[model samples]
Target: MSTTDCIITSSVVPDELRLNVLPCYLGRHYLTGESMVYDWAARLCSSYEGGHWNFFTLSNGGFYMAPSNMDRVHVRWYMNGYSDMMGADAFGITVTLFALCHLAEHTLDDVIVTRYHQLREFAVHHAEAANILRAID
Candidate 1:
């Protein structure tokens, strides 16, 4: 599957904010993947134009899709994990955080768990804090 396959990105404010808010696109969209990266820790995001979907590695662990399209698009994502529908940006962040939390819980790895907490701490200040909390909760 590709990243940002079904997502869009608008103008980034300062370009340095941890959770730079971006506009969302419309419709039910998604990036499709076979099995290239459903188990790895993380990978550097690449340009979708370059044939690779943008997947970003979080500081804690695991990865999330970054909006590669410059035009803001609206996408209603159905998070199968929790049956929750969310916007593109919120979906990416929440799913990434969810993976970290699940990894920590299942593996019981001190390091992974710590990373989950670290990201969770930072997420509280994110623009999509409420959405992230709902998914993670």
Candidate 2:
């Protein structure tokens, strides 16, 4: 595994006016292992550029299970060598707040809103699916 394998970033508006938003990206095989940052986030935010797939979506409900015969992409909430604060769980949330302070100069308002909705909808669907599957088992 790479050293920096998990990273999260956020975009905050009205810096002083915090909102109840949880913008996060959970990159499994999606993220490169060497850095604590995901391949997609690094590419999107222009942080990392060693990936073949540049366009990745954070709106796929966050949970990605490996299809039959495919390589496993673990849902990593934290790395073994990292501290609690540096964990994906903690970083994901923290990056959201920290990102707010540093807004992308070119990021559109509509785009941000749309992405937020996507994240929310996916979260709901993913949760329901998990519950249904759990009940079935």
Best of the candidates, TM-score: 1
lDDT of each: 0.41, 0.27
* Most accurate candidate by lDDT: 1
Candidate 1 lDDT tens digits, 15-129? 3543322111101111111122222213212211322234544433323444444332232224424333445455445545555555556556565555456556556666766
By TM-score, how accurate is candidate 1? Answer: 0.44
C-alpha positional error of residue 79 in candidate 2 after TM-score superposition, expressed in Å: 10
User: Which residue segments of model 1 deviate by more than 4 Å?
Assistant: 1-85
Tell me the RMSD of model 2 versus the true structure.
Answer: 16.4
Error of 1 at 73 (Å): 9.1
Give the 10-residue window scoring lowest on summed lDDT in candidate 2: 63-72
Score residue 22 of candidate 2 by CA lDDT. 23
Worst 10 residues of 1 by lDDT: 23-32
What is candidate 2's lDDT per residue for 1-85, written digit by digit as tens? 4412323222222323222122333223112211223332332232222332111234232211111221212222232222121
